[model samples]
Target: MLFGTSGIRGLYGKEVTAKLAAKVGNAMGGAGRKVILCSDTRQTSPILAGALAAGAMQSGAEVIDLGVGPTPLLAYATFVEKCDGAMITASHNPPEYNGIKLFSKGGEYSKAQEKKVEEAVSSDLKKAPWDKAGQKGRKDFSEDYIKFLIARVDSQAIGKRKIRVLIDAGNAAAYSIAPRLFEAAGCSVVRVNCDKPGQFTRNLEPKPSTLSESAALVVKEKCDFGIAFDGDGDRAIAIDEKGVVLPLDTQLAVFCSHMLSRDHNKKFVTTVEASLSVRETVERHGGRLFITPVGSLHVADEVKRQSAAFGGEPCGEYVFPFATPCAEGLLSAIMVAEIFAQRGPLSGASRGIKAHHMARTKYKCRADMKGEIMRKISEKPQLEGRLSTVDGLRYDFEDGWLLIRPSGTEPAIRLTAEAKSEKKLSEIVQRAGNLIMKEIESAH
Candidate 1:
């Protein structure tokens, strides 16, 4: 079975069933003796975690269930508890969607490890003796996790700025941590939709379209900026003081530039979907940029392999190698503060990070036809430029780039192109999208 870009996420009762969760738990339990479980505010999370615990327990693995926590906290708690980690969450997905995330001490489970788990669930899984059934225990590692995260940043530097931030948690797991973290760092914290439950008062994912309310609040409250965390708190999107939601790629570029300035030779990891501005910013600061196929785990593993200090995705996933591999919103919030205190506000700090015009669009197609469509697109001899098929088909030229890839989470083909100007970007995007649509039609 194919997994999404991240984990086994879907509408809870349908695509992600309790039986499926248990089978995955049985597979995951084989990795270690003590397994730590974490979850978010989704109503189905607790139920799924229970089912997973039942499965893991029967596999002779002790379950350390940490209920209603963020994804990254689970990743960090693994070191403190000395155990492997699993999280029940569907990061940034719809409120009805739920999934599981797996992690090792170094980081998220690698592709090879995911494949192993996938194979186990597909076949009859292993089980231990009745006498050997592992026991279940509970722990809340949030406070310890908060302290550990605090040590990773320069709180003194951030406190000097005394930045006041407005956070829209979207009524998810971020509501549990972001306020406490900013307060601890000496920043005045204002909450919008923070105290609400997991039912989600707004769209779970924070995007430009979904942030009008937050943007207006930031301007009205006179905040330095605003933050909106996705449903699981593993991803975050930001808005500037002027009620302007910052462009995702430019936000990523600013951080990459700052991180590279600290250590010129350090490697920076980002997904292929990242903008040309990322490459420009990293190279301009004398740091090497390593591109990987999309997926937070993929970027995390690549960061470990390349000894990269920082990794980011255009979709707001940020990874700090020193603390943990998972993308923790609380850490990202402070890191954003530290950068502001040192460099300037995001609006000012982003001036140096020049970005090219980009056009991105998607066309719906059946999942079953994706492979055939991709194959035919690859066979096109008339297409130009150096092609990189690492994730899909990415063609690079002197002034621009075009990427056509099938969405792992949906039955659609995503096309993205970037160039120096809007006219060029639109031209490339249109041509690339038309070509892919032809393949989609031909696949039928």
Candidate 2:
């Protein structure tokens, strides 16, 4: 598939290349079509983005080059400009990888739209004649985006509190904008790994394991809290004042609870991978939760369909439909700051939310074997629990649940298990892993 769960992602020169980027641009570009283009901080990003712009301009589409910026910023510009957009980024992937994410004026391309792009790449794409070729221009909307975010939240409250924040942009796309947003919200901002065009000082993904340095610095610097953003600045993981990395699922629940408290809108959306804690918290707040397949695209689409207050994934990507359809990590961090202003502290945000023990592991399986393996596993069910085939096979027990799903972006099958106790969690992981291995062995 040209597009995976996210977009066309792979190694820089292998699966992802300048040729592919140009082809994708040509596929989306046409006479009189205006396309906005941008890139992340990866060394390979500029070349790919330039190639895309070249293709788009060659096809008689006016191109606006925003240069290096976050994916959310690109999406925002696309919406305001009312044009098609493309971002050259591998998102949370390592620097060695790169990809292209497509956007329509409304939101990310839907599955049907992705299929069309794939078909276009396989067919002949014509270029505009020299006389009618499109033009390329440059623009920056950073100020506008920051102003938009400040207006979305209680800037006055945040400003009055004078919240102290430590922001780690991971030296990626949001290097300049993230700190500026926090500062605009009237917060005293301390920055780390926020330098422009610098190689990633830490892991790009904003998970607990990858954010220990930022978490420790949060307490050392006596900051109110800390925020770590992914490579493309679409994911933000918060660190408590005590230098604790808040559990992903717990963080989601706290954000949802805060949103429910502020607005009368009682609808929310999340992915199937979200913890039970999220559903419970949403229900407690008198908010309804809708679950979709794993991916920000699914959550974004569901949020729009339900007119939900917002949507998010446990991995730190959040989408406020009123703000923008793409995951807005910068906005999410500011919301965290606003929460700190309204509430007491990050440590107490999840006071009443129960923490669940979760374990995750993946097994290497060729893409071609995923279908047969899933079929075999489904045919030979060994667990006597409530089975749900929403995105994959999920069995919900009274105290926990197990999910066996094929990776949409990689050649692997993943297993996620959550239980009330660590022992149960381990048992579930082992059993699920064994079951998947057995299926693989049989398929072989």
Candidate 3:
């Protein structure tokens, strides 16, 4: 029943199932009059989507099925249609897992609201009268979503440049959007792992270690840039024209620099896990930075609350308020490409920016033990240096910081560290992970 940091994600058949999905749908629908339904390429998603739609109908709320596509398309449809939206996706989780993410009418959900949806499902609310049952409808908005993005950026400028780009879909929902978007931008695109839904050919997270294929393709194709998207197509990771994998934090810094330089009044939002370099980059361009807790929902909520120009995590999920309040990999790819087109070489574009080393390590732990471990860590006197429990336990020191948070979709504790040196950051993360695991073992 834990909603984790983002939504309710779990292994298929064991944790996530049709009945549970239906219950969640009924809960959301009972609370609202209209709902939008969407799903990703996972095998179990369509079945869950059907159950969700049925439950919504039973609750007397009309269901608009957005069909299979990226999570961002669903969010955009929800925002434009003014309806509560639910996307059935585990989002970067392995093939055995799936989940559901809910958004409010404007494609944003507050923490309080997320908790309410969790509560509604747990409470088993009543369904609407049989005679007043809601109906289900179908919608195809992929092309529309692509066009919406095309209109926002300088497509003409991008098209005029002869850019070679490599795109890795990671066998997720981006397969439905990435190639088309890049082609529209006039780039010679080489696609890797672009396949039908449910065919995941690589690790779904899009992290550097899992992106060797994409990097290889970028180099082999001699592309100017390479982009990779997670399962739900909400987050992205990038490789420079030289085929060097750019860490998520560095990518965020680059994107922030581009936005801040062009739009000086823009305000950017990032999580506590973001690198100090991101704040510095934004400030250098006369823009302000707002740091929120980790999680895309939190980022999106803060974006809506503060009316910020953009929001992203160091993990590569970014939301442009002007485009859509949800993270869109296709949008990020296009934006990054446009930046490279304007700035010449990717390396030159990244020059003159202060840099920091960032690393993340995760430890396997029982979900039930997270609270106890966090409580124990909070009470340890040795760990009281510049600590903030805003979203889990975040310890911020003078030169760097570390964040220990529970994985919302997995049975693991994620430790993220950022400092000036890779060796130092890795050591910090290992030390923290070791300490937390020791605590968890002792609790048992």
Against the true structure, whose TM-score is highest?
Answer: 2
Model 3 segments more than 4 A misplaced? 30-32, 422-427
- As for TM-score, the candidate ahead, 2 or 3, is 2
Q: Write the per-residue lDDT of candidate 2 for residues 89-166, one digit (tens) a residue.
A: 998888888999999984899899999999988988758999999899999899999999899999999999989999
Better of 2 and 3 by lDDT: 2
Worst 10 residues of 1 by lDDT: 257-266
TM-score of 1: 0.94
Tens-place lDDT digits, model 3, residues 195-261: 6667887888887789987888788888988888888888878888777788777788888888776
In order, candidate lDDTs are 0.82, 0.88, 0.82
Clashing pairs in 1: none
Error of 1 at 331 (Å): 1.6
Give the per-residue lDDT of model 1 (tens digit) for 1-444.
547777777778988888988988888885348888888898899889998988888798999988877777888888677667788988777777789888877377777888988998888866888788889998877787778877888888888889999988888887878888788888998899788667688888788888999999999999998888888788777788788887889989987877876554469999888998998888877788899998788787788889897999888889887877776667887788878788877788887878789877889888778888988988887567889988889888888888888887666888878888788787787777778888888877
- Give lDDT: candidate 2, residue 440: 83
